[model samples]
Target: MRLENVSVRYHRRGPWVLRQADAEVGPGEVAVVLGRNGAGKSTLLQVTAGVLRPTRGRVVDRPRHVGWVPERFPADQPFTVAYYLTAMARVAGLSAAEADRAVDEWTSRLGIAGFRRVRLADLSKGTAQKVGLAQAMLRPPGLLVLDEPWEGLDAAARDLVPLVVDEVLAAGGRVLVSDHRNETVRLPGARRWTVAEGTVTETGPDEPEDVAVVEVAVPAARVAGTVARLRAAGHQVLRVRAAGRARDGATPGVGPRPPAADDTALPDEVAR
Candidate 1:
């Protein structure tokens, strides 16, 4: 997808949110948008997702099926979750039976199946966010645009974000995402796009940083949770080992040890 000379403003005389912004993301690629608050990140994403029209320029070759999840899901509607999802599925071109099946599949996968009968107005922010995610994914979209997808999500749901991105990319679809909490670490190799001063700039993938490895010993049961937390916090987990084997100094189930404690070593940061 490509945006050519795209610009946006709420009012004719108001300041421009994006001006002459040109960006592109090809199939099977992911772009992570970075910016400060009110830096036009969401505006650029809206234009890219086909949710809003550029006031002056135009977007070309946007996919027919676009999955857009805004920062906050509109959860104050009166409809029940199941009914809303079913309606959205139909809007996305699914047949009645297919809509039912899709609703069942996504709600189950996102762990909101039990709330199917609950009214949207009654669901919590996190659960409502899941519903937004589920609706966007009722069909495998050709372009997936997510704005702060990790907001209001629990650990399990947060872990699923990467899996969802992978699924879209694996299917040759493009992904555009904006994040403030540094959750993009889970999405390795995504292109970086920064929006500032009504301009959009694209950068290559992150350069390799000189990071020191820190070995963290955790109980067997907590190992998985620790690794997940580290990755989620943008820390690279060099390796994880079974505590039993590490106690015996066995090499089989052990990960590579750090080189040496140096200035870059951050044991305190990793141990938590």
Candidate 2:
């Protein structure tokens, strides 16, 4: 999908919030929109999601099924969580049975299954955000747009955002997301789209930083689990290799070695 020379403003005489913004997101690609507060990031996303019409230019080749999740979900609706999601699923072209299954599947995936009977207005902000996410994903859309998707989500829910993005991309869909918390690192290789002064530009991928390379030897069976634990703790593991045979028949485990004089040391906990 592409935004072609789009320009938007609230009124005819009002200043434009987006000035001739031109951008494209291709299938299987994730674009992360970045900008300071009030820099028209939300407006650009709204335009991409087709929630608001552009005053000038057009959105071309947009898919019929586009899912949009706003930064702050409008949870003041008078419907229960299950009802709202079911309704949204039906609106998205799901059959009655499909809608029921979709609502059930997503609520469980989002950890909101316990709140199915609770009204939207009564749910906590984090829970409401989960509902918003679940609704957007009722059907695998051709284009998925998210604005501050991580806000108000708990740690587990926050971790689920990237998994959803990956699912869409893996299924040959496009994803466009706007975030202020520099969380794009979670979506590795995502193109960066920066909005500034009412203009949008695609920036090149950031260069990787230099860091001390650590090689650890672990049992082949434990390599996967060990790497996951290290990465979860914010340590970058360069690689893992099979331990060489010990001449004395001792069990080989990863033991810390002192850092070189010019190299920075790993954290104490990690080293141990």
Q: Give the winner by lDDT.
A: 1
Taking the tens digit of each residue's C-alpha lDDT, what string does model 1 give over 1-272? 88899999999899999999988889999999999999999999999998899998999999999999999999989999999999999999999999999999999999999999999999999999999999999999999999999999987798788889999999999999999888887677789889999999988777655556456666678888888778767786654655444433346555435444564544432321
lDDT (C-alpha) at residue 235 in model 2: 65
What is candidate 2's TM-score against the reference? 0.79
Best by TM-score: 1
Per residue, candidate 2 scores C-alpha lDDT tens digits across 1-272 of 88899999999899888899888888899999999999999999898999999999999988889989999999999999999999999999999999999999999999999999999999999999999999999999889999999888876787789889999999999999987665556776688888988899986556655545556667778877886677566564443545566434444564444346888754432221
Give one clash count per candidate, in the order shown: 0, 0
Q: What is the TM-score of each candidate against the true structure?
A: 0.85, 0.79
> Which stretches of candidate 1 lie above 4 Å from their native place?
207-215, 220-229, 236-272
The TM-score that candidate 1 achieves is: 0.85
Pairs that clash in candidate 1: none
Candidate 1 weakest ten by summed lDDT:
263-272
Q: Global CA lDDT of candidate 2, please?
A: 0.85
